[model samples]
Target: MSRALRAPMPDLFLGLISGTSADGIDAAIVRFEDGAGRLRADLRLGRTYPWPEDLRTQLVALGQQAAPLTLDDLGELDSRIAEGFAQAANRVLAEAGLTAADIAAIGSHGQTLRHRPQGRHGDGRHGFTLQLGDPSRIAERTGIRTVADFRRRDVAAGGHGAPLLPALHAALLHAPGEDRAVLNLGGIANLTLLPADGAAVRGFDTGPANGLMDAWCLRHTGQPFDRGGALASSGRIDPTLLARLRAAPWFALPPPKSSGRDQFHLDWVETALTGHEAPADVQATLLALSATTIADALRATQPSTVRLIACGGGVHNPALMAAVADALPGIAVVSSAAHGLDPDHVEAMGFAWLARQTVLGLPGNLPSVTGAAGPRVLGGIYPA
Candidate 1:
């Protein structure tokens, strides 16, 4: 059928995703036809539905340092997440004046559990990543073919299997005449640097973003998230603590790398401030650690004149954004909205775009960025 309608392009493809933050599920309906090493897309519609309070609380707790999660708990949580995702897709389709039948295929990233790259060697070859929305359920419920479980294959092929959206970032935001950077400040912060020519894309997870900040806020203020980074801004940055956080080995690692709560959790934050620091001070330092680390990653790429397009939940954090701008003086910082993409929907849209790639038999993962063996096709498809 694709071959029949394959007049160099198709009408639309939809992508669904739930990120490390586990805040909620997002769905993006897009229409794209192949362009030169990229795609021409119309972001038809997008929406976010909050995860059930109980489930969100559970997932957050699991990622936190105070209370650890067990294997059984993780399994059950994954199922609950799958259901939430199906509902999100349904909501998106309805909002877009469409149905499952209107979409080419749904691309879902599932919920990530643990994301360790393969072959840890002496640390043990236990490097593996897990994302849990069941594609079978998604396909069955949405009545559309679904493609999901997008990461592990890269890890198995000796790569990080994350920051998978660089392909989309390059396709959509790479400026023709100037270098640009797409910074996603979700639960974790990651950046995709697009060279002026839009040829090469480089990206990696830059430690923590709202994940640690939110965890800290929950412990101290009983709030799920620090609204607008107000709590953090009200505090003073602890230089000594910031230095310790910057010293974390993850910060020194090279690109084609990724990390999650396993690496940057409340415990890691606490360890940085072990010797008695005020809670607000800790919050401030955590925010600095995130901003400084992301800036450092951008600087390492050494691209000339980077116009940073900030997205995800962190874009709304004025304090965090201020820190980011301050850290990189020469670089201009702006929101993804400037490029006609909503900050909150960028990652979700990336997954939707990836789903299109899968059905079109295109390689979604970037070999240069994720370090996959080559441009291998990503995701496993499950039919309704």
Candidate 2:
């Protein structure tokens, strides 16, 4: 395999992830070559394969409920999701005029089924997270080495096992005397504070971002997401509902924390509603809630962040962007494209980078960001 790929020295690594929104799988092929002292990634090819309707529906239903699945059901769902990811990888390879044999490996984030940064069980204090989709299956199907299950190691080390991209941000975006925060507005929002003064990096989950808005939009308009946040734009925000939503106990928690679609679902949102509000109004408030929480988290950073660089699907929504910028009067809330990487590909690129790190046996988990006991190389590797 090495001899076959070494003709061109295959620097290509693929990353596949279905974010908390449960909408689709983003497959990215990134090339990593030496840049000065560190390896820098160039996203060569990227595409999102929308989940099949039935799988998408199941994902959304499971995400909203965070309900338990029997072992049999769980196994079947995992294998099916892995097949989707494998097909996506094949598609991207075809588009790029490459084959599985020409690639290095795949870093699969899988499909996050459940994430609890902290929870209780009969045994002891446990921090468990589940990302379904079998890496063995991915390796078998793609005929490429696969690296996945990137989070659990940190949890075992007593960390939150999330907000895993701050190290990537530091490597890719940090600049001297220019403190910045990377806000990943996926299904849920996670903010990473990169200090200019060379202080330790800090970040945590801010709360729901596109997940609730997308869910609401689908329920009301039959669309997968609120395009440009138009529905949210059309409706007025309900401050009372916004306040109630923010009043959730999770927001008050300090750093090294994280939340997920599993924690903040449609049912969770209903607890904040008074049962006498417009659906669009609820969506507007949800958007407002996301913006305000993100801003609040940014302001609360210990060293005080200067700029906010946004990414993920939410960055495409103009109304959400404007609201976040409005929430932070002086701070520049800008898209990540200004920093070199496309917003759509940043997270996928991170996973690709992580795959390289794992293959090199370098530490991928940041103790500062994840609250891990120490740095550890993350991910399980499955050979082709």
Candidate 3:
């Protein structure tokens, strides 16, 4: 077959993400190409920008359950986030020996404010998920076409509008010869398991990840996060509290489920505490809860003999990693970097690869993962 007649390689695309953690924004530039039933990526550049303290507080409040903020706040914050994202994208472009015009487009997974996937809300309306980063502004500021707002359409098609990264995980991390589980410990922990023989892929959220523990630390210690999880490592894990936390209904839900700050944030932790525990102990218990639940979900989702590779901000937490290693004996725990990908940049690169899929008119979401009706082209494009 002629080279043109065979699969084609995708050009460079940028991805911007401000996750549910609301701590900062990530910008990544990725080069993607078809490589024998999956896509290969060369992560050219990546950077992160911490959210301004005031904006961070406002965004956290905006995302909190039932917290009311005016339209002005939302609109202004959207612009601010877009500007930060644009600057980060430019930084990546400069580092990668490229410019905005040299790339195809950007794929942005805007900051998620709310994610309600059951098709009903407290007021009895259909399910809706909202992510607030202005794609128009990014496109205009960066002078590149942009593909963004990638989840609503899936929700419209009857999916959870989350755990969308599984599509990219399958494309990039699927070990064709072995069964493997890919876990991302972001604000919430989610896992994607690709059968070694490429039989099937199953994934979902494993309750909370760093969101609760981080929030607890910030509340008590005034730290944006538990640096190296030092606080958690110092305190002791309370098995009794960990048991009670694992009893939440979310843990029992089967695969194809998803969660966010809505279900795993401050309120959830507060409910779990009930004013009976010390803050330090609570932080340690929260860490245990994250590690144990993720391990439990992996066991439930995959058969025995599966290799486990973990990524996301939570992977840096030694306490959490140790706990996970302890919970799943003999399961090889490694970073996505072992597969030639950056742990912190995986999600951002996922969006970039997704944008390449969109530009080529390909399916960007995995129906098996998101539980959408079927494969559908994801994201809307905004031209510079």
Candidate number of the best lDDT: 2
Flag the better candidate by TM-score, 1 or 3.
3
Error of 2 at 66 (Å): 6.4
The order by descending lDDT is 2, 3, 1
TM values, all candidates: 0.93, 0.95, 0.94
Report the Cα lDDT for residue 88, model 3: 80
lDDT of 2 by residue, 166-191 (tens): 88888887878788889998999998
Could you tell me how far off, in angstroms, the CA of residue 124 lies in candidate 2 after the best superposition?
A: 7.0
**Model 3: per-residue Cα lDDT over 1-384, one tens digit each:** 998797544378898998878888888887776766677788888888787888788777665664676799779878988888888888878877887667889999988888887755533258788888899999998999999988988888888887888878887788767788898989989989888787767778888888888788888999978989889878887788788788987789786788888777787666666686777788889988988888888887685646788888988888888888888998888888888888998989989888987888988777788888988888899988
Alpha-carbon runs more than 4 Å astray in model 3: 1-10, 120-125
The per-model lDDT (C-alpha) reads: 0.82, 0.88, 0.83
Task: Give all candidate RMSDs, comma-separated.
Answer: 2.5, 2.2, 3.3
Q: Cα miss at 51, model 2 (Å)?
A: 0.5
- Identify the leading candidate in terms of TM-score: 2
Q: How close is candidate 1 to the true structure, as a TM-score?
A: 0.93
